[model samples]
Target chain A: MPHDHHDHLSPSGHPYRPDQDGPLTYWQAMEIAIRELMVEKGIVTAAQVREQIDAMDARSPAQGAAFVARFWTDPAFRDLALRDGSNACAEMGFEVGPMRLIALENTSRLHNVVVCTLCSCYPRNLLGLPPDWYKSRAYRSRTVREPRKVLAEFGTILPEGVELRVHDSTADMRYIVVPRRPDGTDGWQPDRLAKLVTRDSMIGVAEALPATEAPA
Target chain B: MADFAPGARVRVKAMMPPGHVRTPGYLRGRVGEVERVLGPFPNPEQLAYRRKGDPLDLYRVRFPLGDLWDRDDADTLEAEIYAHWLEPA
Candidate 1:
């Protein structure tokens, strides 16, 4: 009676996601039939299919945090990361796969912004998933040529003195911004430093640590 | 060069299936003439392993910027090309 969203689970066991494609409502017999048919035809093995789905669910955000950690304590490594993004990702136990990725470092003087100018070429291997706003058409079109305007739209006001360079990441590669370390974290270990690299900071939508509060 | 040459229409395809398709929804079901064709290039979606196939032929098909947005409201009449994925349309 209270505008129930999960009405499908009321009578049946299956949880119904309100937002699903197609005209059909929840509990589509067609989906089950198609899967069963595929299984019967041996188009894909059950275990193989299960494992693939499991792999998607198994993804963790720690992969990105680990990447942030390595860049904090090591300057030489940071240099390499800015030079070759894929190598740095590998050093942090992540892979960009066959598609190449680029790493951008946002400093006090320079702001490196990333956008899938064409589409959403996110670094899901490391970042897990892209945030909703990253996928918006507003972000894709405006970020490339009018970066300052777009960043401002995201509530990030780049200082007039600071130069904003937008990186247009396509499908083949990704660009990650190595955020700067906070000021108070003197003599901090890499693990501790990594904690400061918030996802927003890495995206250049927000500045890195050294603000009034450390990143959550 | 003229904005578009004759007999040079191209059918562009979507690079990604879901989430944020690079192809704007407005461009879908629309056809335009091929303004210019670049060399064969690798498909970004396929390279990401999100989609599969070989490199595709990309074209810089011109659509008036105003046409993409709103004809009356768009600031400049400057022409912009959307990345044209090869197709029969």
Candidate 2:
């Protein structure tokens, strides 16, 4: 489909003169020109183009970290997280709305899990923005096909006896992998737990950092 | 397609359209190789913007570590890139 140029460019690029263009950088002019031409000819409407742009422009959820902390404190809530993942968050006063959230827990059965076979479908509400590498094609294609090799690059080479399951997220729904808090963080409070469930854990790329280790 | 093969060198024009779904911001106008050409794809990016119905041509570009970014990410491994051509390369 012939889309507007502004859509493909990422947040890294900002306009040269923000005072006039609202800090919007001309990341790529060719794609944008192609899109504007199509719109000018009535092939597509500006309203329709904006609709998709709006979805991309959606903000990260506010309550995500709080919910992760809630589950960390309540063993019962953690079990609920294992069951229907969204309900667990909702019970703790967080909602995903139309978007879905999948929970990948590190358990005895499996040590780690992650998403992205084709594209990046992260848990925006729980996790803030995705890392730059997540948006890169290297991470997108390698994570699912070679989870072990890719995980190692992230400094997470698994030990013997741990099984890795890679998940592929579609355009619909978001996913979060609850990293089992490290051994040192036993008596930590919910606030501390919130700190533990870093964005990497939510992406299933890196496990949550212990209270001792800094948030990834 | 002169001497064009998978893993050959190419660079994208430093231009973007208004409603396109493209590679992330950090990867514009960078040079890389044609890792694997995915042929034509149903462009989810253009569709996401509610754009036209024309299918996109996909190419998997492989770039060396020293080329894309300079970091201690890993000395051994290489980076892979993916993009769909809007017109001809």
Candidate 3:
């Protein structure tokens, strides 16, 4: 009786249905069919698909943090990033693919925030997968209409004198916000400065952590 | 060749065609200035249909928040719009 009772439960003691175990949806079926067809036709091997997936998964906000940290400490590198973001990333050994990259600098007088009103087009190469909220219908529709309100909800309160610039990633170009360097970190090393660069800061939802708040 | 140079005043065409488009609906018919020329790129409208889309010049158009909405601040919104979607303002 005990064994019979446990038979229906998953290892975690809940009756869970994994995606593959459940009935396949239309899109899932299409994907599987196309993948199989491509593999059968020798267009791409299964290993290649998995390798690409792993490559994408390997990218993370840390890459962006490193780039931003370098930008804060090195003037020459900052100029390169401002001139050509894609090339600058490439120089740092990060592959940005074919999509154009633009660095939006946040200054004392200006603030920049990015959103894709149409779809969730992001700089996946540099920042890894986007957070679910970025792709939500609420974010897509509301960011353009009331950006200051949206930013305020994220705890990013801009001063009245600062101008907020919202970039809608509608087409080919991808943007990365170069958050202003925190005060009192003038002589900080790149490695130490990188710890202050959070994913939201690079995305422009927040600012870099102040020197006093730097993690131990 | 590029039709609009940087700082040119351009307006998004007001037409709403039923197909894949990169231009956002809210920007249609709105006026903005060309912040910069992003050079030629393949048209997504044609590429979405699996056709060989000829390249079109792309521009970073900057719109004042007041012009797009009922805001009184100096905030702005910028979007990458293809050449076909813009007309001289």
Superposed on all Cα atoms, the candidates' RMSDs to the truth, in angstroms, are 9.6, 14.1, 5.1
* lDDT score for residue A116 of model 1: 71
Better of 1 and 3 by TM-score: 3
Lowest-scoring 10 consecutive residues by lDDT in candidate 2 chain A? A9-18
Over the stretch B1-89, how does candidate 3's per-residue lDDT look in tens digits? 68998899999999999989999989999999999998689889999999998899999999998888766758999999999999999
Ordered list by lDDT, greatest first: 3, 1, 2
Considering DockQ, which of the candidate structures 2 and 3 is the better prediction for this target?
A: 3
Compared with the true structure, what per-residue lDDT tens digits does model 1 show for residues A88-165? 877766766665556666677877776775668777777767887899988877765466677777778877777665
Candidate 3 chain B — worst ten consecutive residues by lDDT sum? Answer: B65-74
Q: How does model 3 score by TM-score?
A: 0.90
Compose the digit string of candidate 2's lDDT tens values, residues A106-144: 765565454554567667656655766888888877664
Looking at every candidate separately, what fraction of the true A–B Cα contacts under 8 Å does it contain?
0.03, 0.00, 0.97
Pairs in steric clash, model 1: none
Best TM-score goes to which candidate?
A: 3
lDDT of each: 0.61, 0.59, 0.91
Task: State the lDDT at A106 in candidate 2.
Answer: 70
lDDT of 1 at A57: 65
